[model samples]
Target: MTTGVERLFDELGHFNRFQACLYFAAIFQAISCGIHYLASVFLVETPTFLCDGPSNITHVLYKNHSSSSLEEIWTHYKPGDGPVVVQTSKGDQWELSPCSKALRLNVINFQYDFFGNKTMESCGSFLYDHSEVEQSIVTDWDLVCEKEWLAKLTQPTFMLGVLIGALVFGDAADRIGRRPILMATSLCQFIFGVTAAFTENYYLFVVMRFLLAMVSSGYLVVVFVYVTEFTGIKVRTWTSMHVHAAFAVGIMVVALVGYLVRVWWIYQIILTLSTSPFLLYCWKFPETPFYLMAKGQYKEAQELLDTMAYFNSLPSTLKVSQLKDENDRALLKDTKKHLETEKRLSILDMFGSLKMAGRSATCWAIWFIGSLGYYVFSLGSVNLGGNQYINLFLAGAVEIPSYLIGCFAMDRVGRKKTCAPALLLAGVACILIIVLPQDNDLLAIFLSMTGKFAIAIAFGLIYLYTCELYPTIIRSLAVGSGSMMCRVGSVVAPFCVYLADIWIYLPQLIVGILAFIIGILTMLLPETLGEPLTSTLEEAEALGSKPYTKNAAVDRLEMKQSIKA
Candidate 1:
């Protein structure tokens, strides 16, 4: 017998206007999420700044002068003896020092050459460069010097929210329904995101950002499943790939907005409010029939199917009479059994068998490593060898092609072949950066972008592959678990960038090594291309063992039946 999803597809028609509208509507959520997740790039970026210097120096000598004049005075009076100049083959560069002492400024003269010997004292406050950004959280709150670590915590805080949100909302969506949870979270995201833009205190800002992240995670996870269920299997991969491409567009949108708007709060306001329009139109989207069938709400499922058929300009093929009372009772019994089975299942079940345990462990590790590498490149773009705006845009822009390649590879070759090779290439590219001359920024950026591209491809493929690997009952839980690990990876990403303070290559080294090992682990996963989705835990377990044999006669009969339906 055909499954609920199959039946609906037959009636409503795949790639119809109804499904097209649903996919199009859901994609805005992806775009909004992309902008919100990375808004920290512009929100907390530290502009060029130095200590404000002693009040006596500013008020006494430079009180009447402009901010620039005051800054010049500070530079003159303060230590000209900061970093030591080391001559390199490319150019003169300041050698990084562990303990560059501050000299006290005891005397001042307009004619005095700043490089001349002077006593330097610790600066009491700071003056920031306001040319690019008028005010970011870093400048407004002075999140530098001793408070610098606090600025670093913002990215991780949002990630922690995502980690927690995955566990909470993933289970909730599976139990409550995708439509309700999706709507609830989208509203929450708008509320929290907009509130975050107006926050005056850093701690409150963090809290708001955390809430925003928590809600958006639900939107992201549920919407993917929602869209996938509505589309036919033949075109599902393309549809999923386009969702990610929309995310790339969102990334570019943020870059353009940041470039144009310069003020942090205003940028946040625009980005956060942009998603409101989608929320308004979200009511038109339909809940997945698969979800309704799983809950034993066959009547509602049939009505929805009829509605879809109407919208798609097809006949009302799914009538109430078609859902036989006996079949409905049997489905209810199956649903109850599945619910009870789910209650009994735990994380241990993923590892209940040696074979399944290995696969689960490998999938989790690959998710973590791939996500860690991906975020490291994305979050650390400001530190990359180019203009921050251009770097961020390119980082996102390159992903469009990477996602396209991933879609093609998964469709043609198989999940294992596509994911493993992409990850391996990412690892190799990262490691190759160490061999390139740091002075040659062109080559350095090229290699780094190559790594980013490879990682992006791996990320896109793995999400598709992971969903295919799990049974329906535990699908959300499995994907959520992987996303939990993914969030942990993102949490570590900022600190990875911080490692550059000690050694520039340290972060890349960590990401490269982990990716290589996980790439090998990824190869061990069973291939799932052209395979039907498994519905039971037992079926999922058998995937790694025997290859599925196709029955030509059965397929031909089903094809004829589908055509008639």
Candidate 2:
């Protein structure tokens, strides 16, 4: 059952200097993606602000005082007596209201209003407390007050682009070549990302960001498939999971950069420019031999295999004759015929039978919950009562261990056990936040971080599990469809955070309930721990009807040896 390309990988050695280089190159892409995807967290952050008052009041108040002294004069017109003290477990903390301004009836006395009715009105303009954020979309466009909804709208718009890109580019990579799509998307990501920083208006900025997100999603999808195709089964899981770790590193990098560079547009430019160096070396990148062999270009596949073998210090005896036997040719013909017949099959076709429908639905739901929980935790971390930069850093940092632990658990235990427990733990962590007092910011932060850590595990597990549940014929379609659901979850994440405005605990409550429900529902899924990947619908449907004695470790070793023989 081993493909000729996979056998070529065995001859080249599964893990080698050449493969290491390719792995690092792909890791760099994932890192860039994490930076770009989460950069919006700082870009649109809402800084503390208060009403600027009417022009008459401002002119009269500042007529004799300089702009530097306006802070002294401005205190007389604030709504509160002073900052209100809220008792916390650590100590008492002062909180200020930023939505209203006081109107003075007479500027001369500035005191008698205590006896008369004090007038208060909504802010016509605003003054921001720029101690933390020097500049942001929220400050530049005044996205507070009534305009706050516009700020929350930005992330969902970007995720919408991701949804569309998965549909379009997933298929395009199949029709054209993975290398062309990867290169094209990389170029487009740079152009669109940089252009977004210099936009004249908010609407233009949103449009540019949408285009950037679209290309970014395409690049990630194609690069992942390209890397997987090149890797032998022995090392594929390690390489794939580490790509996500690289993504976490990117998230940490953005947090560090965001802390250092407080200006939003400059920060945007820096993140976009980080990927520019990849363009210089991309020309040397080779197409996956799997793609070449699948297209019947055995000569090119053989030559690439020889180059890889030489670089890996293996013998260069691999040739087109070795790559294509009568059996392989017949198999290729049958595969080609099957592909042609199923070319028009949609995601809905995945539900052709009862067992297929049940498995597909579970996979899709898990995908949705994973994405929803991941983004909700990430975007909501800034709102936790601590240093926003440190909070974001921890959010990214926790994912590293989550990926490591998730990978280990999947290999040692089973995918079902790993995924279900993680989801349940995340649900419990998030739901517990609702019972804590509002002033208990420290405990709230701890629970949220725990939730983030657990959800990261579940999110990572879904990627590997979904691939194993579907047949190779519609594998890409299954992942793409699941990804669409994931993107839908992401698109809804910001709004979930926005729900905090109505009730402070509303977002956490919703996310927790969904995670808990899905955790239970995931038990219905078949465990694919040691199962071989199915190539047809019948084989896929029969995956978990009976248990197998083989374990993943032994199965992997056997597959590698079979390829060598």
Candidate 3:
């Protein structure tokens, strides 16, 4: 009795309906990825009324001899009629003209002046400086909890979870199987996600988030490996690009939802809980033919391959044993090595005598720098304007084209050609945003969006490029470590957001320069387009062999005529 997935794969080629479903489901799971920095839109940065209380406001009204009170101005006069009623760091409130609002709120220009003089807020035309505003409003550490700065400790906590999942789960996939581990990760994702949503204290939320992050990484690593392994040499390139593009799409979707939803925890609930059901569907999913073979489950692997061939109506030659490829054999050998070794595999194993260590390490560095800049740029969108949502969406929307263009070019021009230029352009773009006038701001916003476009491509290309360089055995470990570097980057990205308080444009400029340096460093890496996805240590040691030209690959693919054709 062939399983439903087996019957389906019998019709399709190497892809059964179940595996196809998992692929799409996994991509959609990208939505739950940590976009907290962008999604923090509503929880903070909200505006308040200036005449919020009864003291000087009433006195000022009486002194004016007007029946109209300050409260009336707040009700009747919005920011256009007068300055927006914004709460200062202090408990005090103020009514100033819109021009004065900018001047007063220009913490970069004015914070020092107020600090030296002991006053931060100016009282109307006369300067009644309330300098204690920083101490008062910035209650994140104090009001939230004095040691709350430790909340930033979230990244490392999250990283610890990620580190555990990548090493543990990667090894487990060999013994326990890919589909089961993925299913388990998904359930864990749901549990931790729902748990994190309800935490009472900030620390609890952080801890739950850390756990969720680990769960999330497991699914991602498995999905990336599963999808790429089943993909043909021709489609693998584009499929890899799409996986990462899905992540960017996830970020964009979260930003839009945050804009509409406008609450922090609510956004988490949306991200985490909303996707749990897909995991249910995933429970019924089938294993990858490539993965099953790697585990020495040869019979099961053949059944899957034959089933896939039947479903896709591929040439009958694709049946069972016939589906074998050179890469598939290599994958089996690597799995055997991992199994024979003690449960622990050191990071050094990735480099061991491979002479590929230098290349892999550099790839991780690019991963770190790329992620750091991308998220820093993203998180900083808030200060770009209070309308961070629109800016973020626009920045994100631009990635669709960036993804397409990058996938199209990465193989044609080689990884080096595409990656270095993308990073360099992104850096130049950041510098462009910095030079644009900040306050007379439409042009500024436009230029910043342009910069976003550059970084978006840079982000997409890094993952695709990294996949090609390292072999399959440590692909997840290498990529996960790279992704871990990204989380490290995300951790540091918030601190860059902190920089926005002093000189709003400075963080952009600094992140841009960092991006440029990454591009420069990328020149050191070999172009892996037309290269093999190595299956084990020995092949990786030699630097995976270049396999086919992008054009030749494309021609071969076109000749095959896919469904999209």
Error of 2 at 326 (Å): 6.5
Ordering by TM-score: 2, 1, 3
Could you give me the TM-score of model 3 versus the true structure?
Answer: 0.70
Indicate the worst ten consecutive residues by lDDT in candidate 2: 84-93
Best by TM-score: 2
Per-model TM-score, in order, reads 0.83, 0.86, 0.70
Predictions in order: lDDT: 0.72, 0.75, 0.58
lDDT of 1 by residue, 1-565 (tens): 4432454565567689989988888888778878888899899988666665333332223223223244344333333344322222222122211122233243243321235454444445666768777889998888887788889899888888877776688678888988888888888888998898888999999999998888887787777777777787557777866787877777877888888888888999899887789889777666777677668787888888788888898888675445444334445545754776777457777777887788889888878887788888887766767677888888789888998888888889899998888888888877888776777766667777888898988887767677778766666567667777788887888788789878787888888888888899888888888765555677778786775653332332223222111
**Tens digits of lDDT, candidate 2, 142-261:** 888788878888988988888888768878887887888888888888899889989878999999988888888888777777777778887777677777777787788789899999
For model 3, the superposed segments whose C-alpha errors exceed 4 Å read 1-20, 34-168, 263-265, 313-362, 467-484, 531-565
**Two-way lDDT contest, 1 vs 3, winner:** 1
TM-score of structure candidate 2:
0.86
- Better lDDT candidate (2, 3): 2
Candidate 2 stretches with Cα past 4 Å from truth are 1-3, 54-103, 106-108, 112-124, 326-349, 535-538, 547-565
Clashes of 1: 8
